[model samples]
Target: MAESRNEPADPIVRGTFATAKQSWADLFKWKQRVAVTNDYGETYCEWQSPRPLRNPISLFAQLSARDWLFFLVGLAAWTADAFDFHALSIQTVKLAKYYDTSKTNVTTAITLTLLLRSIGAAMFGLAGDKFGRKYPMVVNMIVLGLLQVATIYSSTFTQFLAVRSLFGLFMGGVYGNAIAMALENCPVDARGLMSGILQQGYSLGYVIAASCNLGVGGSTDSWKTVFWIGTGLSIGVGLIRLLFPESKQFIAAKEAGGGHTSSSPRAFWIETRKMLAQQWRMCIYCIILMTFFNYFSHTSQDSYTTFMLTQKELNNAAASRASIIMKTGACVGGTIIGYISQWFGRRRAIIVSAIVSGLLIPAWILPTTERSLSATGFFMQFFVQGAWGVIPIHLNELSPPAYRSSFPGITYQLGNMISSPSAQIVNAIAEHRTVTAVDGQPAPAYGPTMGVATAIIALGIAVTTALGPERRGRQFELAKPAGVATADEIEVKGKLNDVESQVAVDGEKPDVGQMENVIVDDDDDDDEKKR
Candidate 1:
């Protein structure tokens, strides 16, 4: 096995939140090192380095037909998940009025959904790992479709809450399975770009839901029609997935004896326990990264429109337009930044994006006019989601291949669970700082709350990402060594053929784990003296 400690240890140590301290010096320090050695025995060392940039177009060109198919299906499933989720959120007032209940009660349904999703993510993640990504995802979609339809027909607030809560469970499952299926089969070089595109499914779904609401929500109880539309789309995506074969990567892993050995539940749990023991640290790290990520996204976005409407005093039409602008920036930024991460390195790309996004918070929230708000929102999300675009690939690279579905999925959902209270926290803080409106009514100053929350979350993400390990361009496909019993321990599949083997002059192990297949072929020119 390759030694894993080639990269410099992160400065900000991770432990209990209360005990941890950020290393400000390390935050600005450049740590990457490049080395060169002479072929002839003249000097001890030679150093050369190449530019770390690559053409983005080549990222997509490297993928296969099957890779494209998997990416599309994965993107669609996640998009549908977003669509079904936001469908209820955008129509909360309508639902509350229809059911003759307080809006908070309706919002509680959203909370219930968030609270229960982690359970669903775990259960379905296990199923996907055990069975295959396809079937579990298909089942999740089907259930989501049924629940969405159920939500539409709910006659009582209790029924609506119950159905929506159930919807959250199935919704949680889709992300893990969808991302696993999409990126698992993808070429390693293309993963960053692909991840960027895939993550945008959420933004795309929001746009779709918004569009649907605009089209049908003018009449009384027209929100039901939106749910019906979301339902049909969910079922259609599930059926569409059935048309495709299981991910070749999953099939390969299964045939190579990756997951559980026996088809029994007992075996599944045993294997689960075994893998957990090996990957617990990685799991904790992933959950931490995801918590910051989720907070970064939700704190900035969930109350953005409210900030524009209540604080900036924009009307509904202006706020809606600004939202569109913001999400559009997200879609564009996620794709571009994801592509950039292929060359920039995942950690660097994410850190830079977070920092830039943090800097933009002032302009993002302080704008008084709708035009300024839209422009700032556009640029703000570009950086925010740009950082997010790398997450799917980043998580997959860190995950054990045997539990790719469960590991990333469960970690993501847990992060969601942890940050579920972000909006509430922001609301509470903003509500306490209410200002007198032009109409003599008290209104919360949402701008400053969002600005502060977004800035803090961005800085937190930067610290987490900088200190975190990266496996940029790590290979996803590797054959299990025979009699290995578990795929987790399987040796990386391919080797670098170009570099001739060279001994380490400094008697240090080469940074093998992080290198895709590139071995440093180095020879010390002063070898005789050294020897």
Candidate 2:
């Protein structure tokens, strides 16, 4: 047999700029159905909302027991990564005190961590794709555990920054592997709900880290205790991953000879370059979207506790409590909004959430009392993370079919890289401007700085989301090369030429509804074997 058959090209999808003229008209054209293609082609139709809403439970029931286990494990790994990273962020106050440096200087660790993550994402993400998701993730988590411990040991600010920079590298790889492993096996309709829950792993991490800070007390050295807790979480996730098999989808694709699953170095590079050539546009768009999103979360959150501690004169315990409450709202909103995106359409949900968050910015920071601040912070994160809930699935759908792991991971982290300066900038601006603290002493003007910055970011998120492309239900694992089949896909029903499409002869592409699966995933999992 020939080493490989000719691979079919991706479908023609509209780029963001190409659709700009109709952007205004398209907003009102919600009734139009989204156009889809079997392979990338020369022309395509506009993005639109789907027709009917489905019950979230009914949509959720589509996954097999096997799917649930994999998803939960993926989520655990992601949560651990978040927990490890946020441990440092939530402890910024104590770290500055412990190091006897300015708060702006302490934020340098956060900046270094965020900046290095893009490199880690690119390295580990590609490793997950070319080799397998399991090992890259396992290594990332364990190394992260070590780094957390290292952070606890650092004797100087320079040592701390260096350790955090290393921490960001491993931490960056978790998102791509976790989402690919979690969502690739899920049924199409369940993706929005699941993506929401998965993305909340970050918010959930923040809540837990804040709670850890509260439990450890406000001693300057208490930050190390939180880091210790982070160490346990990271190591624990790494060990837990060791118990699982390779992704069932990865295994299936390999057996079927369908995906770019070749473990060969030569095969991997060839496929990688081709995917980039075809997918560069989608890559740039995802990066730009993620830049705004990373900025959205960091600007509003990283300095929040500091804002409370200084401007509002809340004690550390109170600031931590408010943060927990805020992220709890984030958890709830992400789950609910993610579920709604199933029927509401991904882009629309994001736009509405971003806009609502902008309107809430005034209240989010203006509150002077602990309870009021907690309430506003809670509502603010609900919309903020609710907008974020769509991202995991959105990036996956927009990725090159075979490059899902690296594409989503790289773009998301690159966005993180671009927005890496968020915390430092916020700290810098807050320190310069003066505000009257509750104690009647002059303090850094955190409240107004956060409000103005967040409002601008919220508006940007809304507009960027509106103008971007979405492929809500793209099949990551199922789609095979179009117009070509491996000799292994024995179940393909038509002649090789006819399989190209019955209407291709007339120079017209068939409707997506008329397309066939052509191949089923490897039925080797226990659930499928039992069937």
Index of the highest-TM-score prediction? 2
What lDDT does each candidate get? 0.75, 0.82
Cα distance off (Å), candidate 2, residue 127: 1.0
- Taking the tens digit of each residue's C-alpha lDDT, what string does model 2 give over 55-165? 777876888898998899889888888888788888888888899998899889888989999999999888887777899988889999998888889998889888888
Instruction: Give the TM-score comparing model 2 with the true structure, all chains together.
Output: 0.86
Candidate 1's C-alpha runs over 4 A off are 1-52, 100-102, 217-220, 257-264, 436-441, 479-531
Per-residue lDDT, model 1, residue 40, is 43
Q: Which residue pairs of candidate 1 clash?
A: 36-46, 41-525
What's the CA error at residue 352 for candidate 2, in Å?
0.7
